[model samples]
Target: MARENGLQKSLFALLAEAHPEAIVTLQYQYRMNKDIMTISNTLIYDNKLKCASKSVAQRQLDLPHFQQALDSIHGGASCTKQSCWIEQILDPSRKVVFLDTDKMSATEERIMETVVNKAEASIVLQLAEALLLAGVPEERLAVISVYRSQLRLISQSLRGRPGVEIATIDKYQGRDKECVLVSLVRSNETGKTGELLRDWRRINVAFTRAKSKIIIIGSSTTLSTTALFGIFLELMRTNNWIYQLHLGAENEHTIQPPPSPREKRNREHKTHSPAEAILKNRPILRDVYNSSSL
Candidate 1:
């Protein structure tokens, strides 16, 4: 009886509920690489979503192009030890990346009612610039955040750099970008993930907007406090897609890989069941599963 809008379900929701067998879900997603689409498919679509074709499913960022751009930006200097991690995470072969800010000195600040994280904004801007320098068309790239304050900060810093759209997740709902950079702007010691992030619909929109590459920048320790994000972080760890930012001496940055698979499995085995149980209890997902059972 919990309706999407306050007191009533949308007509579409009502139809789907009344005629579950008549639901004609679109199973083929042509936009995102399969890896980038997995979270939404699993949580919202019941693992029924598929890539339209092998080419679309397997597409990844163009690494050589990015390297060439980096070389140009660095005056043809080879990638130094400090900058190697950038190259590794931005390597063209990676379609989905979770840049864990848990190890970095990144924290969120409140601006009136909205929130912003300077560290997260800085990292997002750096990566967006790198992507542009790598010859990705300005229009093909986007920076999405869940907070208006974070979006405003990024927009102010990115002034004069036209065409790379910066907006909140809701603004980009029906839109797609070739490369999308998401700034999850909630990081605190108390583990308070706000209500906006707790809503799975917005999270689904944020995850499914990218065509080739999607880079999610957030504090894993902080975000893992939420069940949905906990599952997401677990999946990222299982897939070896997490890259932790390590701040070295004199403020150098490095990307650290997750633990070995054996260690990861052992850790996951201890913490996975609660999130699974929570997911199973979610009403929207329960409806999906019930319809499928029919």
Candidate 2:
């Protein structure tokens, strides 16, 4: 399996070489949560969404363009996790779910499993971003976890935002989304790395949950990119992967989004500051929440 994956990695590298602008096929970060939510109690029209003092995600909520993006999401994008999102686009009532670790409340078994197995937790913020753009009300959306405490922090990131709720991956396991957006965060040989396979199976589980499509936000390095000391660097010097994804529609729903830039360490800007949140283990939705301390 590892060797097969290695070949896939080589192909990806070739594709990356010929097409340097390619983004990772594996996509969206995974998240954690605990609970069995039927319907969200929140609303998107709340005042918190309008404040520039919040997540770019929140700021995005109020934009007419953002709403347009959701309305424009007509599908055909290649994602296993995306199947549900596409359906949600076609049918707003379609169920949507996010997967992540959920058992870290006190036992920390899942978290430890992830950590000891070389796991770097991933959060589904981008899938949430796409859903947010697709007009899925936060309340209609659900976040599920394998470990509750592990996901609590991720849940807090989307908290008070409106239209979304949290749940456990177990609850949504048997269910399907119109499309599924599985986010893979950190995958190393640790608990997280071992969980990488489990996560992959879970992702397969998540993908099958979607009746139509599945989109993955994972390590582009897995196939095309390479990770040296945990930093993502491209390896393929030949094939260039973008053309494969861009085989047809030269203009339509085609143009691949740019891969994260080299300076990606600072990509989130002030609003989507994962580092700040990681440092504090709390959501810091501002330009510089650390300014006061600085």
Top of the candidates by TM-score:
1
RMSD of 1: 23.7
Residue-wise C-alpha lDDT for candidate 2, range 1-294, written one tens digit per residue: 865666534565677889977754432212211000111101111122121222321211122344455434435544433433333333332222222222211112345434211121222444454555655555545544445554565454554444454554555765644344444444332323333334333433443343322333333333122222122112111212111111121122321222243334455464665665566654454435667657
Per residue, candidate 1 scores C-alpha lDDT tens digits across 187-221 of 89999999889988888999999999999999898
- Measured against the true structure, the TM-scores of the candidates, in listed sequence, are 0.78, 0.33
In the order shown, the candidates' Cα RMSDs to the true structure are: 23.7, 22.2
Q: State, as a TM-score between 0 and 1, how close model 1 is to the true structure.
A: 0.78
Q: Against the true structure, candidate 1 has what lDDT? A: 0.80
Off-target runs (Cα >4 Å) in candidate 1 are 1-11, 72-83, 248-294
